[model samples]
Target: MEHSTPYKIFLLWLLLSSLMLSGVFIVWDIGILRAILQQDITRISTIILFVFFGACVHCAWRSFYLARQALMLAYLQDELVKEGSAVQLLSLFPRGSCLAQEYLVGLYQGRDAQDKVLLSEIMAESLRGTHQVGWFIAGIVIKLGLLGTVVGFVLMLSSVSGLDKLDITDIKQLMQQMTQGMGVAMNTTLVGLISSMALGVQYLLLDRCADRLVVDGVNLGQAFMSVSFDERSGTL
Candidate 1:
């Protein structure tokens, strides 16, 4: 596959985007940020959620790299078509493009039923790789949220475990304990749900791009197939 941009460029983009997102969070919801930071007793799970969110963003950007490559290659297909050489396509497919590779394989090897199966498998594998980490990220944040809920409950229960006489002091202490538990429970749940939802949307957009890339690749490969091998064998 032709590399339109280096991996380093993608890394730079991810870093900038992360910074931009963080800035937006500060402006839009600094309350949550403050809540997490101001705690004398830090919520470790909330901190971990932030780290997971960063990973999701990085993965989403990587998938976007494929989309951009697909768009560029599709646009250049026509100009390359007139050249009538598969060899010229080597640079266009970039090393990361599994979809383009399938089509290229069909161009040399027959595009029969077995080849179709092979291509389908290739596409599935590529899609799986694209999707796997995204949902895992979502799941992790959700599980963390649940874990926080359990922790909150345990803390609340423990705080009230010594309750004996029905007195104002004991009642006030119990309420304070319960309030702390509720804060932990609510805050973690809010963060988890928000993070998972945002990540899901990001992956959804990226996957759409990937689907288009596959379509474009298939179309280009079919076009490539139409050119006689005699016509296709030439130097760029």
Candidate 2:
């Protein structure tokens, strides 16, 4: 199977993101999003939720691209088995350019079947680790947002309590404090909710992607082994 260059995939993603960001800015300028944000803490939270949702969408796209690459690599390995020449297989891949190509070269150079299998497993693990790190960062953003919301609530409540002790002569001052406190409190919650929701969705999508990769990798490995066995038997 022919595979498109990773650069092309990245460029596509960048273009998509730019378009999405432009839409977001339009909504912001039109006061639609601002009105929603002003409604209450919940609406603010919704905005936060969607931003992370966008991130998850991007991650899912990445996973799909990675899966395609893995399938291509498997197909290439199968071709190598048919050709029965590791050096010829190496020539088929782009020289010193793609990491996947390098990995295939390493696999082909392995001293034994077990060595090749080990290398494949190591490659899968490395990819999985990188994906997990992205999810971990998303989780951190969520937690920080939650913390901000909590702090905001505390301050808003404190302001309300202080207002209870003030007289009518302090009404203007009390109203100002109340509005400021409420705004701050709501802002934090909005940040937290948006961050948490977005990240949570991304985390889940990434997990699914990882699972799919593992399943596909195993299937590809089995196919490679079968092809190798057939070639060896033909020689005998």
Candidate 3:
């Protein structure tokens, strides 16, 4: 836990910081900070929602490197599975494949049904961080968007409820407040849904990449599997 804690924290900070940076970039694109801040075109929650979208983008971007490595590893493993001995592939496991290395070594030893199941679990666990990080972050972005939606709804409701109390002079202020509330409501929901879709697509690709790696690995391990015909043991 202690060793892994830092990595998790880094990812957390990276997501948040990326969101903030992306927000800044978007704002800058519209105009400089001075102009964007003074403009009434965008709402605060809308900006935050876009920032969250940026965070989702960052997750997809980060997954690219891991997916590429996994794809390459799959290719190499498939080649080895076709013609080579398990012993010959030890040197070929990519970096950050400690758990996979252990699984391969175990494979070289033997792989009955029970062993295969155990190795499958190990493989999933090993690949989770690399292949699923984007998906996890995407989930977070979707939730954040929902949170924004709730907040927006609350603000809009509050403004609506107070409308009866406004006098003639306050009508203008009330209208402004209502508009802001509506902006928050509409923007948050739109950003959240859009971000989730993009993130889902991004992770879908990464998952296929992981699937290839797992398949190639399974094939590699099964290539060297031993079968027994002993009556006591049955066929294994």
Pick the TM-score winner. Answer: 1
Worst lDDT window (10 residues) for model 2? 1-10
lDDT per residue for candidate 2 within 1-236, as digits (tens), equals: 32344434335445545665686689789996676566444343554556565665666566656655555565565665577544444466567533345555665456687887776676567556666666665766566556656655665676668666788888887666666556656565555655555555545655554455555555545554555456556752
Per-residue alpha-carbon lDDT of candidate 3 for residues 113-144, written as tens digits (9 for 90 to 100): 78877886778666555546666666776676
Ranking of predictions according to lDDT: 1, 2, 3
- Choose 2 or 3, whichever is better by lDDT: 2
lDDT of 1 by residue, 89-194 (tens): 6555555554565556655566476785577457646754657677787778877777767777777787777777557767887888877876777666666666
Better candidate number, 1 or 3, judged by TM-score: 1
List TM-scores for all candidates, in order: 0.74, 0.61, 0.63
lDDT of 1: 0.62
Q: Which sections of candidate 1 miss by over 4 Å?
A: 1-30, 36-42, 90-102, 229-236
TM-score, cand. 1 vs. native:
0.74
- Which prediction has the highest lDDT against the true structure? 1
Q: For each candidate in the order shown, give its overall lDDT on alpha carbons.
A: 0.62, 0.58, 0.57
lDDT of 2 at 42: 37
- Give the TM-score comparing model 2 with the true structure, all chains together: 0.61
Better lDDT candidate (1, 2):
1
